[model samples]
Target: MLRRNPIDFFNLIWSDEAVQKISKNTDLITRSKIEQNQENLKPHSRLRKWSSPSKADIRRLMGIVISMGVIRLPSITDYWSSNNVLCIPFFREVISRDKFWNLHVADPLPDNVSYPSKSYKIQWLLDHVNMRSQELYEMGQNIAVDETMVKFKGRIGFRQYNPKKPTKWGMKLFTLADSNTSYMWQQNLYVGADGRETELSKCAQHVLDLVEPLSNLSHTVYADRYFWTLGLAQRLIDSGFNINGTVMPNRKGFPQRLKSAKHMKPGEIIAFRKDDILMLQWKDNRVVTMITNNCRSDEWCTIKPKNPNHDTRNKPKCIADYNKHMNGVDVNDQLCTYYL
Candidate 1:
C-alpha cells in the first residue's frame, strides 16, 4: 500500500467499507429527518430534493468537501456563486450547495436520543482511519506521541480549552505519529472524564494503546511534558520501549539540584541517572530539562553552522535527537491547517 504514490494510495487508507458506511448512514439519516419534517407538516425541500446517494456519489461528495478546504472562499455559500471570481465551476457541475449539505455524513446518527459516545458522530470514521493507518504502514523504530486540537467551537461535552494551542478551543486528541515520515498511526479522542483517571494516569494508558503491537519492539517514543512523567518513563523502559521527552517544570520527580542548575553558563550540560532512567538538564539561553532512557546522558553533538563565518556550537546529542524525533504530530498539524 505504501508503494502507491500520491493520492492513489488514499483509497487503501480510507478503504471501501468506511466509504460505504458513510453512504448508507447519510441515506438513513437524511431520509429519517425528511420524514420527521413531513410528519410535522413541514416539508424539507422547497428546492431540489435529496435522493439517496450511492457509494460513488458519497465519494464525489467527499472530494468536493476536501476541495472546498483547499480552495477557500469567504463563506460556504460562495462555492456556488456565479460571479467570475467566486464561482468554482466544477462544484456547480457536481452538486448544488443544498444537495451537498443533505448528503454529507461520515458516521451514523444514534437511533435513540441516548448518546453511545461523545464522538459518535464521526467515531466510525476515526476507528476506520486509525485501523487502516497502522495496518497499511509500519512506523519506524522511533515514534512520537502528542496531543492535537481539532478546532470546534460548538457546544460539546469534551471540548477542550488549551491556551497554548493555535486553535485554542476545540476537541482534543491523543495522537501517535511516525517520527520518520510524519504519518499519524493511531489516535484516541479525549472524551473528558470517563472515571477516576487523572490526566497524568491517562497519559500512561494513551501511550500503551497508541503503540499497540509496537510494545516490546524497542521502539523509541517521544512526548512533550503534557504526557511525559518520570515514573511512566521508567515503566515504559521496563516494557521494552525507550522514552525521550521534555520534562514538565514541576516538583513531581525532578531533582531539586538540577532545578538550580539554571545558574550554569550557556551551553553547559548536566545529567543524573536513576536506575534505568537518565535525567538531563542542559543550559542554553535558559535551562532546558529532559528525561530519557535511550541515549547517553553525557553524549554531545557538534552543530556546524552552514555559514563558515558563524561559529559552530556543541549541543547535547540527547537534545538534538529529542527535537528531531518529536515533531511528527506538529508537522502533521501544520500540514492539516496550511495545506488542507
Candidate 2:
C-alpha cells in the first residue's frame, strides 16, 4: 500500500458547466409556464414567490434544498426556526423559508398542454437530467441494470410498492449503472401509463431501452430475473453484447425437467444450452437458476460464507460473477441514502 494525493487520480469527467446550462434552461421554462397561468388567477392567488423565477432565484432555492439534506431536520419549519437560522449563517443569508417552500420546477399550464401519465409534471427536467448523464461520462465494458426506488409519499399516480425496499411507497426508476463505480449512466421513470402506453407494454423493453446506447460496444451486462429472458439473451447476443443474470423458474422456455425435479441435494447442478443462451440451476440452500451467454459451463469458484454456521463453498462462474458485479445500482442507492 502507498500513500498518495487523492487529487492526482481523481477524474472529474462530469461537467458542472453543462449541468448549469440545463438548470438555466429549466428555470426559463418553469418561469414561462407559471406566468402563463398567473394571468387567469386573482391578484394574490397565483404563486407569490414563483410568479417570475430568475436563474439566480432558482439556484438559491436549490442550495436551500441541498442544505436541508445535510441539516437533517424532521420538518421544513424546523429549518427556518430562529435557533437554526441563527446558527446556520449560509441559510440565513441566502433565502427565506417561504420562498423555498414555493419553489416549483415545472409550470402548471392551461388545458391545452396535455399531461403525461408517466411523468406529466417533471418530464422536461427528467429528460434533461438523463441527457446530461450521457454527456458527462462514457460507460465501461461491464455494466449492471436494476430498479431504484425514490421515496415520495404524497398522493400521486405511479407510486410503487416494494416490501423489500426501505421506502415501500414511492416512485420507481429503472437504471443502468457502471459495475465498478456505481455511476448511473441512464435512467427511466416508471410511470404506469402516459395516456397512450401502459407499463405492461414496456416491461419487456426495459433492458433494451436503458442499454441501447451501449449496443455494439461489446459490453457485458448483469441484471436480475426481472429483465433477463431467453429471447432477450438471444437478442443481446445478436447485437454483439453478452448478458448474465438469474432467471425465474416460471419464465417461458425453461426446461420442464428442471422445473419438475425435486429432492435435489446441495451443490447439485442442472444446465440447459441453446446456441448462445445457457441456463443452469445449482442446488444451494435453495435452487438457484442462472442464465448467461458468455460464461463457461465447467467454470467453478469459491466464496467464504458470512454465516458462522457455514464454511467456504464452491459456486458456478455465472453465480459468482452475478454476485460480484450485479450490485452497481445497490451501491449507488446506499451512497445516496447517506446524504438523504
Candidate 3:
C-alpha cells in the first residue's frame, strides 16, 4: 500500500466548515466578479432546451471560487479541488490570472498562461517599504549606513571588452535603523563604482538623500573614518545633528616642541601646556592625553593608565616616542578636546 500524502489530510481539514469559518471570514459571493458577470451574460432566447443551473450547481461553483480565493495560493490545490485554481485573494478582491492578464500583462499574452507583469508588483512593494521607513523615522531613531559588493554572473574579461565589468554589479546599501528599538527604518540600494574619492563622494550623497527626510527626529548617523570627512562633519553639525563617531586623523601636521620632552618618563606628565591638559605615557607602551572642557588639573589626575609598563619593548613609549612611532598620534587628546 502507498502512503497517503500529508497535504491530502490538510485538504480535508481545510474544507471543513469550522476551519473555513476560522480561516476565512469573507462571504464567497462578495469574493469575486465572476458571479456578477455570470448574471449579466445574456442567453439566446431561441435555445429552448437550456436551463439555469440548479441551486446545488450554484453552490458548487461558489465553493470553487471560494477555494481559489480564500485559500492561500501556496496551499490552494490542497484546500480546494477545482479546475480554475489560479486566483488569489488579496486586498479584499480575487485576483485571477485571466483578469490580471487582461488588465496589465503584455500584449499577445503567451500561449502558456502566466501571472501578471512583475514590474508593477516590484514598484508596489518598493512603495510599501518606503512608507514603512517613513513611519519608523518619525519615531526617533538612529540610522547606520553601509555598503557591500555583488558580483555579476556574466563575464567579458579584465582590460578586455567584458560585459561583466559594465553589467556585473555591486551595490551600496543605506540602512536606517532605530537604536533603541532595534528596528530597521529604511534601505536604499545603489550601484557600486571605482574606489576613487569622487565616486565614493557620490555614493555618500545618495545615502544622505535617504537620511535627510528624517532630520526632524532625534536621529544620529554612525559611520567609519572614511565616511567622516571634515566637510561632511561640518555639514552634519550645521544641520543641528550630534555626531559621535571616530574623528578622522589629520594627514599633515607639525611636531610639537616641549622644553622638558627629554626628561619625560613613561607614565609621567611632561607638561600641562596652555590648555588644561595632561599628557601621560607608560613603559608598557600605552600613551594617552587627557583633556577636559572644565580645564582643571584634578580632571587629569583622575585618569589612570591601563598599562603601567611604558618603557618595556612590548609597550608604547613616551609621548615623544609615540609621536615617532605612530603615524597619526601627533594631535594629542588635549589638542582635540581644546579645538572641538
The clash count of every prediction, one per candidate, is 0, 0, 11
Which is the better candidate, 1 or 3, if ranked by lDDT? Answer: 1
Q: On a 0 to 100 scale, what is the lDDT of residue 145 in model 2?
A: 92
- Higher lDDT: candidate 1 or 2? 1
Backbone-clash count (model 2): 0
Model 3, 178-295: lDDT tens per residue?
4445344565544333344542266456556656776645455654434544445445545555443322233112124331245455655422333222222222233233211122
lDDT, candidate 2, 274-325, per-residue tens: 8878888898889888999888788999888899799888999999999999
CA lDDT of each candidate? 0.81, 0.76, 0.38
What C-alpha root-mean-square deviation, in Å, does candidate 3 show against the real structure?
Answer: 18.5
- Candidate 1 TM-score, C-alpha based: 0.91
List candidate 2 segments past 4 Å from native.
1-51, 83-89, 193-201, 305-311
TM-score of each: 0.91, 0.83, 0.35
Which candidate leads in TM-score?
Answer: 1
**Would you give me the overall lDDT of model 3?**
0.38
| Candidate 3 C-alpha error for residue 309, in Å | 20
